[model samples]
Target: MSESVLKTLVIYTATLVIAVALASVLILIPAYVHYGEIHIPGSYNALYLSKYSPYKTIVVEIDYQPGMEPTPKTIEALQQQIEMYSGKEVLVYLDQDIEDDEVPAVIYGYDIIKITSMLQEQNRDYRTGWFGGNITLYILYLDTIWQQEDQDYSNRMHAASTKPYSVGVTYAADSIIIFKGSLPQNDMETTILLHELGHVWGFGHTNESSNIMNAEFEVYRNGPSPDDVVETWYPKDFSPAQKEELARLHETMHILALFN
Candidate 1:
C-alpha cells in the first residue's frame, strides 16, 4: 500500500481499538460492581438495598390531593406495603388543603417544606430517579401524570423510568407519594403505587410479568404479587457479602427508629 493509504488504515484501526476498549469498560464496570468481585460505591448497580432495614426505621408521608378520594382499602394497603421496608414503623397522614402537615394529601407549599425537613432531620436514604423518595405529588396540576385530550393513552401513562429519581432518601419524612385527583377506573393508581413502592425497596425493574418490579404496569393489584418476594433483597436472600451490607444498613435504621 502507498504511504498515505497505510497511514489512513493505521489511524482507523487505532480509533476502532479505542472505541472497543471504552465500550468494554462501560459494560464491565457495572458487572464488576454487581458481582461483589469489586465494590464501586456510588456507582449505579442493579443490586439495591432492601426496603426494610433490620437496623433502620423509615417513616413516610402520604398526602392526598383535594377532590381525590382514595378508599380506606387503598390507604391500608399502602401502609401495609410500606411496612415491609424495615418491618418496624411507617406513618401515613391523609387530609386535604392543609399546610405542612406530616402528610398533606393536597398541595400546600408549607406541607412540602415540612415533609422535606422531616426527611432531612431523620436522615433517610432515598433513590435518585423516579423510584426514590416520597413522590412529591401535585394534585390536579395537569402537568403531572394526568391524561391530556387527544393524547395517546399509552404514551401519556406513567412508566417507572419516566420519572427518574429526583431524590434518593428513604425516611420518615423524605419520600413523598402524591395522589392526584380522580383516579381512573383502570389500574393506574394501584400500578403506580406498587411500582413506586418497588423503587422504595431497592428493587429494579425486571422482565418477569408476574413481578411488581417489571417496568410496565400489566398487572396492577393493590399490593405485591407472590412473585415479588422471590427477588426481594431481604435477610432471606442475602449472600455473605450482601449480608454484611444489610447488617450495616439495618443497624443504622434501628438507630433512627428509636426517635420515631
Candidate 2:
C-alpha cells in the first residue's frame, strides 16, 4: 500500500476504536447509576412496596414479653434514626401484654432459620398483603433466655426477613427480635435496633466501623495514641452507600409495583 494510504487507514482505525469505547461507557453509566450493584431476589418480582409516596409509612408493631419491653425513649430513638436514614415516616406501636400463647418458641444459638420458621407458624393468621402505600413490620421483644454461641449476654440477637414471601400470603413475620438481657446499657439499645432494621432493608454487615451497619459494632478512628484506635461506636445514621442502596431498592420496588 502507498505510504499516504497507510497513514490515513491508521488514523481512521484509532478514531473508530475511541468512538466505540466512548459509546460503551455512555451506555453503562446509567445502568450503574440506577442499580448500583443491587441484586433483587426473584421472589420480589410479585411483591410491591412503595417507599416514595408521601403517604408511605412503615408500621412497626412491638410485642414484648413481661419485663422485656423496650422503653418509650428507646422506641422514640429508633423511629427518629430510621426516619433520618430512610427519609420515610415510621410509626412505632407497643403491643403491651403479649401472652405466652401469642409468643413464638425461642430457639438458641442465633439460628435465624429456626427462629424465622417459628415466627411464621406463630403469625400464620396475620395478613400479609400490600396496604396501599404503606408497609408493616413486626418486632418481638422476648426474655426467653436466648443465647448465641460466640456472643456474650451483652451482645443482642437481631434478625429480620432475608427474602420476600409470596404475594398475598403472610408466611413469616418481617420481625426484629430484641432479647432484653442482651441489652445491658440503655443507650446501646437504639444502635442494636438500627442494625436489625438495616438487615430488614437488605443491608448486610459492613467492615467499616464508622457505619452503623457494621456487625462488630466498632469503628477505627484516629486518637491521642500514635496508632489508630479501635473505639466502640454506635452510628446514629446509615452510611451514604447504605442509604443509596436502600433508595435503589425502593425505586426498584416502586417500578415493579406498576407491572403487578
Candidate 3:
C-alpha cells in the first residue's frame, strides 16, 4: 500500500477510537447533587408550630393488637387533644395490628423504643415527607404490660415502689405504648391516652391531684372516690398549669427535620 494512503487510514482509525472513548465517558458521567438533612429530635418537635421544621403536616398512626382497639370516644378525644394543643391540622390513621399473641407479654423500658421502631417500620404507611412536609405520632395498643427496666436490686425496688404496671408509657418523643391490659375498658382508656399524649407534648407528670397528667393512675381509677371515672365531677382534660405551659408553644419556635 502507498505510504500516504496507509498514513491517512491510520489517522482516521485513531480519530474514530478517540470519538468512541469520548462518547463513552460522556455517557457514564454522573450528575451530582449535594444537600444537608434535618433530623428534628423526635420527642417534642411534633408540637412546635414553626416554619423551620420540614414537617408542615402532622400525621398520627395507631397500631393495635387484637382486642386492644381504642373506642370511638377515645379516638375522638385524642384528635381533639392534638388539635387543641398543636393548633395544626391533624390526621389520625388506624394501622395494621400486631397479633394479640404476638405482642410481648411484658416490654422493658430500655427495649420499648427499639420495639417501637421495629413495629413502626412494619406498620407505618405515612412517613415523614410522604404526603409533603409531614411528621408522625405513632401509638401502639397492645394487650401487654410494661415493666421499667430494673437492672439491679435498687433499681428494681425503686421501679416497683414508684411505677405501677404502666397503663401507658411514652418510649420516644413521638411514640406511645398503651398497655391495654392495664386499662379498665371505660373512660379510663380515653384518660390514659391523653395522659401519655401529654408526655409527647413535652409535659412532665404533675402533682396536682385533679389533673390528668398526674404520674399515678390510682387518683383517677374507678374507685369509690368521686374523681374516679373522670367524667363525673371535673372535665376530662389537662390541668390549668399544663394548658399554660402548652400555651407558650405558639411563640416557642424551634424547628427541625425528619427523614425524607
Q: What is the C-alpha RMSD of each candidate to the true structure, in Å?
A: 15.6, 13.9, 12.2
Q: In model 2, which regions exceed 4 Å deviation?
A: 1-55, 84-89, 100-106, 109-126, 131-134, 148-173, 218-232, 250-260
TM-scores of the candidates are 0.37, 0.54, 0.67
**Residue 36 alpha-carbon offset, candidate 2, angstroms:** 22
**Residue range 96-150, candidate 1, lDDT tens digits:** 4333333333223234445545533443333222222332211111112321123
Model 1 weakest 10-residue run by lDDT:
135-144
Best by lDDT: 3
- The lDDT values for all models are 0.37, 0.52, 0.63
Mind giving the per-residue lDDT tens digits that candidate 3 earns over 58-98?
A: 78889888778888888999888777766777888885568
What does candidate 1 score on TM? 0.37
TM-score order of candidates, best first? 3, 2, 1
Q: What's the number of clashes in each of the models?
A: 31, 0, 1
lDDT (10s digit) by residue, model 2, range 1-260: 99999999999999999998886556543343223212222222112123543335666677667677788777887777656545567777776545565544444453644654565456423322332544456677765534334344332323221111110111122556675543444556677776777665556678876787776652222222323334344677778887676566655534332221
